[model samples]
Target: MLLKDHVVLITGAGSGLGLGVAQYCKAQGAAVIVTDIATDKIQSLASEFDEQDLLLSCDVTKIADLERCKDAIVQKYARLDAVIGAQGVFDGNLPIQGMSTQHLDQLFDELFNINVKGYLLTAHIFADLLKQSQGALVLTTSTAAYAADGGGAVYTATKGAIRSLIQQLAFEFAPEIRVNGVAPAAIGNSQLKGPKALNLDHQKQSDIPKDAFLNLFQSISLLQELPNAEDYGALYAFLASKQNKVMTGQTLVADQGLLNRAVLTQSH
Candidate 1:
């Protein structure tokens, strides 16, 4: 009940880490507003929430759509306690050499629009509301932000931009709104999709071979196990709660000790 009576807005809440945070926040007594591009993905899960917990169809890249979501939240709750930007698309690890120039351009636009610009727009649209309540902002970044091979160059760059955004915005919004991020690696059974420009929009991380994916994690992670979407929810919840008073402009890396293993092996 750390978030009791809090009003939280979350993007990409239909699946993956976003959905998990929405559920956890709701369970902690927050009025969660869940937004996703795929309405059908959230329909089955809708019954579990109360009527006050809204599930809206939102395209994160569209400013109007985000504005509409903001308006709805204002109309209902009149205040926002937290904003979680979780809408993102992967690159399927397409190497730069493998992509044509035109394909690379399209991929850049698609990924940046959703992964980087989308987070910016969410903060922009909700800034006034958040300031009114002195709310917290938690953005979803990736382990790819710091490590190579987590994704291709483009995906890595976009996540890096997100990490930068969190720090810069924290400095700007401090004393009124706090900003932070969660960077997760190899979330098991994630429904993360790739950009359509690369013809990977239909691709789901869950579609990959489970055993092979697990094996890949085992090869790199000191924990030797993939973290689940729910494993990340508590981090988001804590970042969005009053409990995180002294932290901002920082990212919590939840990568199953992958970075530690990488450094250790390199030293050996």
Candidate 2:
């Protein structure tokens, strides 16, 4: 297995991409520490994991919660091989022209807090442990960073920030730890929700009509199918593994060829 004998931490693993990657890491023989802010999700995950794995209600944006998680990990395994940051929020795809100043202000804070700040805090809190192990940090960005209409303005901006953060962190932590990012195009099972500022928190990317989404996605990219969460698992597993010796300070575009063509040529 790629990650055999490793100890990995996955944040925002209550559902969606985080959940999928956590399971894949476990199957690859890593002792996984899965955390999310949802208490019910944590409770539900308990039965699937033995005492060997740690599950907690961790809010990534809060230092105290992250510190508690770090202490528990250090007490249990004493070493962390990789940290996969998978928590994020969608910006409801509402263009800036449609939003008022108040809407934009609140939306920016909410999305950036969860989507950008969460990764920043996680990296800061866990840097020492990862450095000790000379491990890896795999962050999640999006195809929005490269192309237009991948998300709304705020969401795209947050992703761009993450893409830059990956490079900076990789450079700072170099010769010891690897920092990288995965920018996925379309995840078939994405539960990425929107900001509460515009009252769009109830909306999720996963709620899209499957057939319509598939048809639109298929028409644009060379790869006709929308990749499922598990399909991206192996790539994450590899990046978080010791086998990643050469690559660093980069964001791999796992976009299934979506950005290669004129997918956004007609967008205003």
Candidate 3:
């Protein structure tokens, strides 16, 4: 019951890590507002939610869609206790040299608009509602924010920018609302997709063979096991809970010792 009686709104909750977070929060007694760019995707999970919960179609990059979502949440619940900015796009690790000039601009815009600007807009539009409830904002970052090879230049830059946003927004919203982040490495069964501009919109990380995915992580992580998207749920819950009053402006890394290994190996 970590989130009992809490009302949380999550973006990209149609699949992957966001879906895991939504389910976990609901199981802990929270009323979840799940949103995704694809209406059908959100509708597919309708059976799992009660009437008290909400499922809406939201394109995180659009202010009009966000404003509509905000209005719906306020009308239904009267207040919001937590907001999770989980929408993101990958770069498929496309090397800088490989990208044509035209594709590079589109790729950068696609990734930043969704990954960084989306979170910025979410926080901006919802700041007042969150403040009214003295709530928390939990954002998703990645190990790529701190290390190389997790993504290509564009993806890494966007994640790094998120880390800065977490700190900056936390400072700006302090004493009224708390802000924090979770930085996870690769999830074995994640449905995370790449930008359409890169022709990877249909690509899902989960589509990779299970053994191959596990082997890929096992090669880099000290733990030698791939983490599941569900593994990150509790961390989000903890950060969103009212009981977690002292923590803010920080990102909890859940990379299974990958960063540690990178640091140690580099010291040689």
RMSD of each: 1.7, 2.4, 1.9
Tens digits of per-residue lDDT for model 2, 42-68: 899887788778998999999999999
Q: Candidate 1's residue-wise lDDT over 46-165, tens digit each?
A: 787888888889998889998889888888888899998888999999898999999999999999999999899888889888888888999999999988888999999999999999
Model 3 pairs in collision: none
Best by TM-score: 3
lDDT of 3: 0.92
TM-score of 1: 0.96
Model 1 error, position 207 (Å): 0.7
Better of 1 and 3 by lDDT: 3
Query: How are the candidates ranked when ordered by TM-score, highest leading?
Result: 3, 1, 2
Give the alpha carbon lDDT tens digit for every residue of 1-268 in model 3. Answer: 9999999999989999999889999998899999999998988998989999999999999999999999999999999999988889999988989989999999999899999999999999999999999999999999999989999999999999999999999999998999999999978689999889989999988888998888878777888767677778999998998989889999999988888775446431
Quote the RMSD, in angstroms, for model 1: 1.7
C-alpha lDDT of residue 147 in model 1: 81
- Whole-model lDDT for model 1 versus the true structure? 0.89
